[model samples]
Structures are given as C-alpha cells and as structure tokens.
Target: MNDFWQQCSTLLEQELPSQQYQTWIKPLSLLEFDIEASTLHIAAPNRFKLDWVKSQFSSRIADLARDFCCKPMVVHFVLDPKVARRANGATMAGSVDSASVQLAAAADLTAQITSLNSTTSETSIGQQKNSAAAGSGWSGSPLTNHESSGAPERSKLNPVLTFENFVTGKANQLARAAAIQVADNPAVSYNPLFLYGGVGLGKTHLIHAIGNQLRQQKVGARIRYIHAEQYVSDVVKAYQRKAFDEFKRYYHSLDLLLIDDIQFFSGKSRTQEEFFYAFEALVANKAQVIITSDTYPKEISGIDDRLISRFDSGLTVAVEPPELEMRVAILLRKAHSEGVDLSEDVAFFVAKHLRSNVRELEGALRKILAYAKFHGREITIELTKEALKDLLTVQNRQISVDNIQKTVADRYGIKIADMYSKKRPADIARARQIAMYLAKELTQKSLPEIGELFGGRDHTTVLHAVRKIADVRSKDALLNRELHVLEQTLKG
Candidate 1:
C-alpha cells in the first residue's frame, strides 16, 4: 500500500504543475494504508486541501489505484497531526522541519516525518506568518490523492477567487470588509458569517479567500469548506452505510466550516438534523462558520427553524448582482488571467450584452476568442458581434420551423424532401423531428407553419415531434452536440 501511495504521488507530481504540487501536494503525508480493507490513510496539512482533494481528485486516484495495483482503493484523510505522527511512526524519525525541507525533495522520507511532527509553536511561528502572507496573494493550488475511508467526497474551490480578484463595489463592500476582518482575526468579528447572493456573485470566492488567509496565518489551523449539497450527500451516504457517528465526528472536529449553497438543504429533513448538530458543535467551540446561500436565511423556505435561527445568529451579508462598471472590471480581470488583451470597447460590449451573470460574461468572451482564433480574425466589435450572435439570438429570439428543417437537413446530408417523404426510416424521422423543433425555436412561425413545412403535418403533430426530439436530444450526446452546432451556425 505504501509503494502504491508512492507511485500515486509520483503520478500526481507528473500530472500537476510544479507550483501547484508545491502548494498543495507538498504538505500531505501518507500516514497509513489498509490493504485488506482497501483504504489509504492520508494526513493533510489543513482542512481546505483535504476537502479540495476529496472533491476534485478522489475518483482519479481510485482509478489510478486500480490501474497500478489491481486493487480497489478508498481514501481516508486525517487532518489530525497527532494521528498522522502515530500512524507513520517509522517514517517520521529524523525528518527535518517543513520549512527546512527543499521544494524539489519535500516528498522525501525525511520531509514527511518533519511535516507530521511540526507544531504551531514559537519556532514555527515565522514560517506560519510567511505562509499567511503568501496565501493572501495566492490564487489556487492543484489537488492530490490521499487515502481515506468512505469519507465524503470533496469539491474544488477556485483558487483565483481570493481577496485580490474580488472587486469591492457598493453592494458587497460591507461584506468584503467584514470578511477581511474575519480572515485577519478569525472567531473575533463574526463567529458565524452568513453570506447570501444570487449565482455568480462573489460569495464563494470571499469565503475561500478567508480560508486561504487563515491557513496562511496558522498552518495547523483546521478549515473545512464544502458545498451544502455535499453535506446532504454525505448524510445520505452515512445513513445508507450506518456510519453516522463517523460523519458527525468528521464535521464536528473542524475549526472552521464554510458551506456553500446552503439553500440546497432547505427541504432535506434528515440532512438538516445532521447539519444542525455540526453547526452547533462548531459554533460552541468558537470556530468560524461561514455559509453562502442563494436566498437570505428568512427567505429560504422549508429549512428548519432552528437551523435558520442559527444561520441568522452572526452578521448577514449580501452580494448584489454586479453593476455595469463592475461587470467591465470583472471582464478585464478575467481577460488578464486568460492572457487576452481586451480593449475597453470590447470589454464594454461584452459586459453590456452578457449581463446575465459573471460566468456568462466569461463564457461569451471565451466563445468569441475561440471563434476569432478558429477563423483567423482580429478581435473587433464586428467579430465579437458575429461570434456571439448565436448565443445572443437564442437568449433573445425564437427559431422558426423552416429554419430548423433547413439546418437539420443540411447537417445530416439529407434533403428537405426526404424529411417529408413516406420513408418511416429511423434517420429520416429523426431529422424531420429535429427540423420541426428548430423551426419552433428559430422563427416566430406557428406550429401549423412548421407542420405544413414538413409534409403538411398538423400543429399537434409538430408538438409531438418537438417533444420527442427534445427527449431524444437530452439522452443523446451526439445529437445534442449536433443541435448546438446547428444553433451556432444559424445564429452566427
């Protein structure tokens, strides 16, 4: 099992970039392995890395284990330093402190020992301070596979959503300040910070920035951040496997808990019970608990009253949808990260049209850039308009039946006549129905117009065709891709 872990580490080193390996992978120690139980025990430097690896890379590691050792593997992550030291007793002897370990050779046996034994004392205080300073500017780190037993899977939080990237607008300014204060002095300003916002607002980013700051300040600090959906899923999994005690123990031990999308637990009674206990445990211990939800605590219907009251105990902050200027700033920042040079005009145009969300703004930019690169065109107003025409049209206008028939027939190498012909063939029917649905989407033409276009069929017939095509498209990836391409072609 140790050899397998070493091999897994080598593979991870090859897979992740050097910088990411240094930040996230270097701090992990393989504490124990249970080959008979197919479990691998791992010690994470902090809870954030532990959640990240479990969320993003556990399955990848499991697949690797199967490939390398012909055995199934489960990862058990222990964030406790004492547990790690005890489990890897032989490996920890004579290991230098983590600060003294060289970057390239940090995975050496000596370094592992040092990492397991390092403490939050005066001798390590300077290193912790430096790490905290580094984290304030750090973006994100890569994930690694450590062993754990049936632990809840982890989710990846974007590293770039740090304090630096978060633009301080009037809407989120107070929340930003409060979050900063909390990060600077955890469990001091807001014991249970409640941040609520619509999608793509900076709630998750702010929470992560706080966690990053805390980890940097105190390397031994325990921070556990997860999506509420994950908490619910863990509850379900625990109930199924009768491991409820372990589940509670896992969350109750956290020094800080950041739960995203807390609204997801609104109606889940059992999960809410588990979460309530976890919430109270952390709060009682004076651990910082930050939560993000789509709606305010009062507005989130179906949540237990006790849970809602607990959520409202701390300072409540809301991140409003970004205004025009803020949107432009976000675009500029995103463009900078992507190494794309965006003129003020281009950024303004994108921000004006893609006001749906920040993610949409970035997606539009990516699409436009991709289209420009693919066609060897300069990034200009005309190019941007053309590149985004399809998406914009779908967002604003409907497609006609004639348009759908024409687009589908052209794409499938079949004639429009063949679509209406008495051929009950599989391919022809599929094409004909797709044409009917496209007409429904691309044009203002009525269902009768669509039906008449396809062999004088009835409006109801067009409706049925549309429904059938939609059902097929949902399950068929190739069909979905083809439809997307057709949409792009028509709109562009």
Candidate 2:
C-alpha cells in the first residue's frame, strides 16, 4: 500500500506544482487497495483538504492507480484524525509542531491559567499588597506575593517565540525593540507596550517573546500571557463562580501581564471593565503590561475610551508586512533552521510572490519543503515557482492596479468610479491617493503606468501620492491600518 501510494504521489509531483502536490496529494494515504473489487480507498488529513483533493485531483489519482494496477480503478477519500495527527506531527528542528498542535497546547495553557488564577489561596493577598508598595520597576528579580518557591511560574507562553530567534525587519524592528525594552526593564520602560498590525505580522509572537523574556529574567515573578478571548472567558467564569476577588487578586498581583488581541474585548462591557481595573491595579503597583491588537489603540472601536487611553499612554508600535529582502532573509533563515540550505534564488522567488505576511511565507515554504522532500528533488528557483504556482496566479490576478482601486474604494464606502474621478472631496481624494500608493506597492507597473491608470494623471502625481501616503502611514495609525487592510485585500 505504501509503495502504491508512493507511485501515485511521484506521478502527481511530476504533473503538479510543488505546493499543490504537497498540500493536496502528499497527505493522502492508501487506506485500502481492493484489487479484487477494483477500488482504492485513500485517506486525507481532513474533510476540507480531502474535499479539495476529491474535487481537483481525485480523477488524476484514480488514473494513476489504474495505470499502476493495469485496470480501471475507483478512488475513495476519507478523513482520518489519526492520519492527520501523524502528518501534522512533523516538527521543524526544535520548533513547535503544526498549527493544530499549537492550538491544542494553547487551549491547555488557557485552562491552566483559569484554574491557577481562581484557585490561589486567599492568604496570598497580603503578599501582593506588600509587594505593591515596594515599587514596580522590574529591576532585580522581585519575588511575587503568591510565589513562595524560588522557581518561575508557568507563564503559558510559547518558549519558541523568543526574541533571540525572532526575525527583525524595518516592519517589526520598532515593536521588537519596545518589547525588548519592556522585557528587560519590565514596568519602568513601557508600562504597556502596545503592538498592532494586520493578522500574522507577529503581534502575538512579540508579546509571547516579552513574557518569555521576563520569565527568564525574573524567575519569581508572577507572569501570565493570555489571549483577550481567554481573558473574557475567565471573567465570565469568575462571574458565574462568584470568584471575582480571586480573579482580581491574581491579575492585580502579576509582575508582568501579556495580553494578545486586545481588540477581542469589543462589546464585552464586563470584560473591559474588569480588565480596566486590572490595568489600573497592575500599573499603579508598577507591574509591567504588554498588549497586542489588529489595529491601533484608537482604532479598536467598541473598547472603552479609558482602556484605549491606557493602551496609548504607553508606547505603541506597528508591525508592517515584511519587505522583499526581509522576506527572503526570513525564508532562508527558516529553511536553515529546518536543515535545508535553500538558495537565495529560490528564496527570492518565493518572497517575491508572498507579500502579505510571514505566516503566508511560512506556508509556502512548508509546501515547497514537503514537495521537495516527498519527491527527493533539489530545491531551486524553478522548483519554488512550480511549488507556488497556484498562489502566484491568484496573487498576480488580485494585485492588479484595477483590483487595488476597487478594493480601496469599496473599503472606504466610495464608488469604484471615484478612484479615477477628478473629485477632490476629502474622503474620495484620500481613497484615490491610497489606490495610487497601492498600485505602486503591489504591482510592477511604472509610475507613468500607474498615473495613466488613475485618469491619465502625470507620473509625478502618482509619485507624490505614493510618497505622501508612505510618509503619513508611519505617523498616522488609522491610515496605516486602512492601508494594511487594503494591501491584505489586494493580495488575497
């Protein structure tokens, strides 16, 4: 059965690009080879991937089986958790497993956090009160009121997400530096170092890095890293359990607090109110706080103004999409970590096409690695191209100047015509400027070409719009978020 599946995959790899072959066909297994019945049962990781393979590559798989068996064959696909788990267990050297593993571990950690916070002895409250009066500057390792042992508490942070291994680029350098300062100095440097960006730009990773850093520096510190959603769940549970005091006590006593995706508190008034109190308690005691969101503090619409103001009171940083060189460097470094010496040419090829975020880049790299490993082929630029053909086609189609204009205009609630119109209303004109900037960023079109697309304007007009938006985005968080959304939409 293994030999039969190998033959089928080999044929598919030769026929399809690396990404398609690896993503759809490689995870499949020969569940059953019914020679007498002229049927072959195949297994896919999950229903979604199986459905994709069934719709897109089932016929080819059937044909391959028939060619190998010298008869007409029917291929059946099934979802098997056992098979999926086995496939996802593949690890990068010393790195965390696949996304599923990460999610499962995160859930377990969240449970531990809730349990630990609610179950602490009431006797620990005096310790926190005494410590609060000592000063919050995270200098030498200060003992927590609750922590009697000289051992570190389980911070529930991903140890792999450390600052040492984090890839730095202009996009994330500011956030990374602030995280470092907060981690090194704790409460004194940036009380609540807030990080914001589009999804997958490493906000979560940065916060976890801070927690991990502090956990190492202050072994006796009470450190907690949690998603805002988990924090909300904790609040709800505390309310139901009538254990708000313990909750408040546990949170307020922390030497450091790391919260990811603070935007999740939207419309959850109770959660916001609870978190505000905790924020005040921690900051007032000189404890460190770090937060992350998908946008700037002022842009998170349903969160309380007071919470937003607190978030802004500390340093706020943005992590933009990686530039071309940075993306290539990341690919190379990640490949090296996996013990694969990928060439710069191949890295460039993959980086040129995957411009949205690091996760997207990692996904493409995984596909390429899987395809190359499955087929025992050497990595090359042409191979990278073949592996990412589907993604390349979609990105090329989506990042066109016309698509950018349409996406930007639609997002701003303006008509598509307004993108090229001569209208100079504040909103419409701003939308036009954004479209022009995107056209320059996403496409290979020259300045003159972009200008021509924008109602036959001059190249200097396009360049000026590009320069102005580029300059303003660094200082204006709202506009920066808008551009990030437009870029993500265009890339997708």
Candidate 3:
C-alpha cells in the first residue's frame, strides 16, 4: 500500500503542477488496503487536508490502486485526530516550512487563495499604545486557520485566501509583488497599496493575503478586512445606534485596514466621511491601509477630490486580465485542485474564448467539468466544444487584419493607408505594430499572411511587431490599457 501511494505520488508529480503536489500530495499516508475487497485507506494529517485530499486526489489515487492491484479499487481518506492534536507531528504544520524545494517556483505565479504560508518581516506598529481598541471591542488575538481571533469583532477574512495559492503570470506580476511587499513590511511599505482592476481580477485575494500576513507577523495588531458596502452599513448602524464614538475608536485604532471594492463608497456621503476620518487616523499613526476598486483611483467617480488625492498618494497597481499562458496555467491549477487532469488543448480552447477575467475563465472550466461528469464522458476538445458551444458562438466573430488595422488607425488618429504604406513616424509605426499584434492575438492568421496583408512586409516584421507590443504591454501601463481596451472593443 505504501509503495502504491508513492507510485501514485510520482505519477501525479508528472501530471499536476509541482506546487499542487507538494501542498496536497506529500502529506498523505497509506494506512491499509484490502486486496479482496479492493479498498484502500489513506490518512491525511488533519481534517482540512483530509477533505481536500479526498476531493482532489482520491480519484487519481484510486486509479493507481487499480493499476497496482490489477482491478478496480475504492480509495478512502480520513484524518487522524491524534495527528491534529500534535501540531508538530502533522504533515500540514510542516507543509510550507518543511518542503526542501525552494518556494520561488510557487511564488512567481500570480493568483488568488490561501497562501501556503507567509514570508514575514519587521513590524512598524507600536505595541498596542491605543488602549481604546480594547474598550471599543477591536482587540483580538492572532488568527488560526478556520478560526477567528476569538475577539468580539470578526475580520471576516477567508482563511484560504492567501498568496501561496495564487498562480501568477504577466498579467498581475506588479500587483502581486506590491502586495507581498506590503504583507512583509506592513505600514512601512505602500501605506495604502491601492489595487485597481476589473472585477474578479484577484484584487480581493491580494488584499486578504496582506491582512492574513499581517495577522501572522504583528501579534495583537488590530486588523480588519471589509467590503466598502459593509463599511457603509456599519456607518449607517452607528448613526442609528448613536455609537459614533465607539465606531470611531474601533476604526481609528486598527494596525492594518484592508478594504475591498472601494468603488462601492461612491455616492455614499456619510460612508465616505467616516472612511476618510478612519483613513486619515490610520495614516497619521503609521498603520497600513489597503484598498481595492474596479477602476483607477482618479477615475472612481462620485468620490471627493481630497480622498482621491490621498488614494493616489500611495502605490497603485492595476491587476489586468491574465494573459493566454497565465489563463491556461490557472485552468490547470484549478482542475488539479478538483482532482482532474485537464489537457492543454482543451485549456487553450476555453482560454481563447473566455479572455475577459479569471472568474469567467473559471466558469467555463466548471461548465466543462460538470458537463463531462454528468454525461460520464472523458474531458476532451470535443467535449469542451459541446459544453461551451454558446460561449463559442458569441466569440466566433472573425476579426481580420484589415479590421484590426482600421480599428487601430482610428483609435490612434492615423490613416488606414499608413498601415500598408512605409510610414516610419512614431505614432503611425506604433499603431501599425499594435494592429499587427492584435491581428495575431485575435485571429487565426499565420504570421506570413498577416505580414502580406500589410504591404507585403516580411514575416519577421510582423513577428517583431507582435513581440514589441507584447513586451511593452507588460511594462507600460498606458499602452497596456490601450491594448486592453482595443481587445475588448474588438471582442465585444
């Protein structure tokens, strides 16, 4: 049984991401196997891991058992409560700390979810100088997985939303790096750490990660992670209850404040006033504050100019849509967590059609998984097509090089004739390159064909344009935004 489990682990290492294997597979132990009954028993370190292993690895392990026993087998996973009692003895307690492999492999991936653990550093908050937090019901102990701080006020942070689990790519590298720096240094690094992006672009995940990291590092630091809507509600309740003093004390004394979807504060005058006071108080005391929104701080309408200026004062990073390769990695990681092996071709098919955000890409993957399981069929390109025919139909519009050239030209205030003519001016050349890049990205045309469409230029010229735009888009925020808008326009 032990040998069988090891073989299964080895096999899975080949099929799943390395982080998935280390985080989910290494902790499992084989307890028993009944040859005649074809039953295999597996032990996980704790309940959290037991459930995850059962859902994410049981099927694959059962397949290995079948191979080992020369027949079908049922894989059963359970937690040893004894192991749970001995924190040092459990595999989970050592999950992030014990692995011999360097974690940079996992850290480089931008993502969403619970980080396996945090890389903690120095704290800037003085040790509980504000006694008002205790009286205002804001003081709390450090958090443990699945359990709150055991104080009157709950932070409402998901224990599983950490940095280790987030898969990173070109799309969110800057945002993730800034989040880590804030997590490690707290008030000293990126005081506000303004994260802006479209919906479901991992802004909430990154903010939660910062809070969780702070909780682990800064003992007795008052921390709160709340949505803008919830903050508004709290303001309303305080007004009704005449508890403004308590609210002020509670909000102003926090060592770390993580607020999500700040756009929700727009048009709410009272909430804005309250939050402004809290923000000013925290910043004055050198406490960390992190905010997330659907757009840049300057573009967030209905907010005060003073508040906007304050928001822009800190480090602001946009979490853009994950690129193609990043989208595929996300799909594979998600499937691996669900105990399925999704092939690259099918991932590419789904990724190409759902290019807006991580949430939509995940929705597409879930549909395909559900459709396959419902019909008792293998997941393949054909099955993916059948599952997402509606999405495919919506995205099936043909975007040609001519259309791209015209679109880019109009947007950049250049003539379409310049796309084919030898126009070397910076604006015209830039627009031409952008059009070529879009043509390659949104259409199925070959490089040579795309080149020929632009005044019979060589394939290398087209390739150079694609490479230049791709490289620039990652580093240049303005150009990245322009490309993002153009792609959306063409797709829409």
Per-candidate local distance difference test: 0.66, 0.73, 0.74
Off by over 4 Å in 1: 1-150, 153-157, 394-492
Model 1 vs. true fold: TM: 0.51
* Residues 137-162, model 2: lDDT tens digits: 34344434433222223347799998
- Candidate 2 stretches with Cα past 4 Å from truth are 1-134, 137-154, 407-433, 444-452, 455-465, 488-492
Compute each candidate's TM-score over C-alphas. Answer: 0.51, 0.65, 0.68
Candidate 2 TM-score over all chains jointly: 0.65
> Candidate 3: which stretches are off by over 4 Å?
1-155, 398-403, 442-446, 487-492
**Backbone atom clashes (below 3 Å) for every candidate:** 22, 2, 12
lDDT of 3 by residue, 1-492 (tens): 667777888998886555556556776777888989888888886555576567545666777889888999988887765675653222322332422221443454433211322223222223432432333323455432312222125466787878877767666877888888777656655778898888888998888887877677656667889888888888887788677777787778677888989999899887898889999998887778899988778878999888998898888888878765566667777876788766545665677567778998889999999999999987877888999999877766646678889889999999989999996999999999999999878875667778889999977688789879877887787887778678767756
lDDT of 1: 0.66
Candidate 1 per-residue lDDT, tens place, 77-192, comes to 77748633542221211122221232223224323333333332335444444553344322223222211565565544466668866654433555676687668645545668
